[model samples]
Target: MTKQINLPFDDSGCGWYAALAPRPDVKRLQGRQQADYAVIGAGFAGLAAARRLAERLPEARILLVDAQRAGFGASGRNSGFVIDLPHKFALEHPDPAHKQRLLRLNRAAIGQLQGLVEKHRIDCQWSHAGKYQGAVGPRGQAYLDHFERLLGELGEPFRRAGREELKAVLGTGHYSDAIFTPGCYLMQPAALVTGLARSLPPNVELLEESPIRRLERDGQGGWILHGDEGSIATPTLLLGTSIFTQEFGYLRNRLLPVMTFASWTRPLTDAELARYGGQLDWGLTPADHAGTTVRMTRDRRLIIRNTYKHVPRYGRSTSDAMREQVRARHRGAFLARFPQLADVPFSHTWGGVYAISRNFTNFFGELDQGVYATACDNGVGAAWGTISGTLLADRAIGAGSEQLRDIEAVTGMPSRNPPEPFLGIGVRSRIQLAAWSSRSEL
Candidate 1:
């Protein structure tokens, strides 16, 4: 069944992605169009797929359609952190083998991302300094303990830092312990997406300010996507829209798209740089119940955000509650993390919606013949999206192997059910309790 969810991009006047935009403009689609494959949504999944598909099928005609400008969706607005660490340890699992295999897959995916960005010369400010997730206080220490053990057990290359080392790296007295993982990297997300969008070979046609209003099965064994400019007919169709609102009826409940809000401070002044650190650090987020993710803009501003998870809230009509709560968290979060910069003024605050799936991971595979789908990155896309796009493209070219068919993700990488519905509520609520119980004085 097609979902009846609302598209958010039509509402929000601006998104977090506007900060470092590529500003690449493509010609709009007009009249009737036909192609070997029609890919919808120009975010990572669609663009990635389009890029690879061209490399594999040089002769095939490809068309990538987007509701807005390419890379203008969550792809441009995300924290831009290339998640290196493993997905958090699961509360329910049969054996450690599945987790181990996933770690290997994650490593391969990370390697592939690094290789692709470098080979393609993608200028998304890819850096591999790793991430320092600060664990402060007694409770915070224990929380880091669980994650550390999970990585070690899964044989992930990780190192835990004591209070002294943590202070050395973070220059903060608030944190008690920390875990550094190499699997994650920082990215200039919009730049990366825009770079890829512009790199699409001339063969792949792109459309902007166009949306698929309806999909009708044609008598000729193809799907016709009705757009404002015109209709596109293709033998194969790929749905890259992360959250299928009521508009896309195929998936109403299968995917959860959540909107996350963020505010980027103006470039840090020299005084502010010295206050935090005199280096271009990737980003630092404290380990708390409502932990906020922070990163440096190429210009150096503290980008802070944390609100809403595992559901679809993107584009135009993001809730006021999500924005207010995130702003509140940012105000108090900085004070608790660094009393040194409590007076810094925020430059901008905006929100964007990203997709999450049943497994809290991106899912890819054929839904039916001639209709292959991919999406639901949870909060982790960027690198993973690149991984997914490349894999799907290879499959289309018949070069993909079953062993590489890891897209049939575990039923619940995070939880089988909706995180908020029951599974998420259960796990996150406990995590919150533990976080609260562990803090010294919030």
Candidate 2:
């Protein structure tokens, strides 16, 4: 039976850290403000960009705005995996040079994340156990074979895991072939975003609940952005609005609105461990979303969702019913893979909206002279978000950023906008197909 997704905003859906933390209310902007640059969206991308901007331009007045509280958007309520899939695999860009640049940028982004975690003394439970992608049957195996060949051609550092080796790593016989890589990292995503937002350089002003009504361009190549309570006029703008930016002028047609959901398990105590294979470490794309990622929270709760999508999942909400169904499906997999935790009372689940482009690339460029955006991370990864932010800040400060220029050269994949209305039907059908296929043999 299809489950209903009602409470998409509930805390349980965001996994452990977000659930444990206090839900900070969104603070509405009251009147007026002025800054050198205005940044919208408090997610990882926006927050990180704001931080770097402060570092580069210590004296530049920065205004950060979000529709909700800091980390309340996708950044706070995500799987929080710090994995970076080279553009070659996830993106259809055939340019090996572009792929290499992506690899370097991602590597640098991960290093930046690590440095921030250490510098801030943030307790986000960071780890670098890497990640595994397994194919349980023929269909999945075919993709694995193709992926392995690509890996070989790319000369990426990777290994193929046979059935026995896969079993040893995952403690399961559910997979036939696997691909192992060392770029994936895991963390408490909400904590990381919230931690970063909390320690702004004391110069960046964060305004939450400040829904931008519209950004009116002035004659002087500046913008007058207004919120319900306040407004700001700035010569420059940084649009961190991932999915919602499309609501504006040029960005509307640029971003493809997409929704992805994740389900988290109730925390598992010690006795539960001894009863099963003691599932530790983390696994991603346990099923079809070989592109998405999955893993276990620090408290040993299973987070079964790299991301779930249909043909036309527009907007930024998830179904409560679907989230519960995901938990049930994960429970079944847990029983099959490690029977010990089947009975754990499933406590929490959550979902969020991630923006994507038709070509699976993100929007990161100076849309206008002063306005810029960095969004569309199809994968539940933070590397892109971090990279986007740094690039945005670099542009905002007039600093020379070669990485940004190189990426800008390759425009996002030609967008294939979903047909309105029926688009949902298409996405829904694809998701259902993948789910059914995961259950049955290849």
Query: What lDDT tens digits, residue by residue, belong to model 1 across residues 22-43?
Result: 4655677789998998888788
TM-score to native of every candidate shown: 0.86, 0.88
Candidate 1: regions farther than 4 A off? 1-5, 10-16, 89-94, 285-290, 309-325, 357-362, 409-442
Q: What is the Cα-based lDDT of residue 188 in candidate 1?
A: 75
Compare the candidates by lDDT and give the number of the best one. 2
In angstroms, the error of model 1 at 262 is 2.0
Please provide, for model 2 over 169-253, each residue's C-alpha lDDT reduced to its tens digit, 9 standing for 90 to 100: 5656767777888887888877788778877897898887677777787778898887777888899888776766666565555
**lDDT for every model?**
0.66, 0.68
TM-score of 1: 0.86
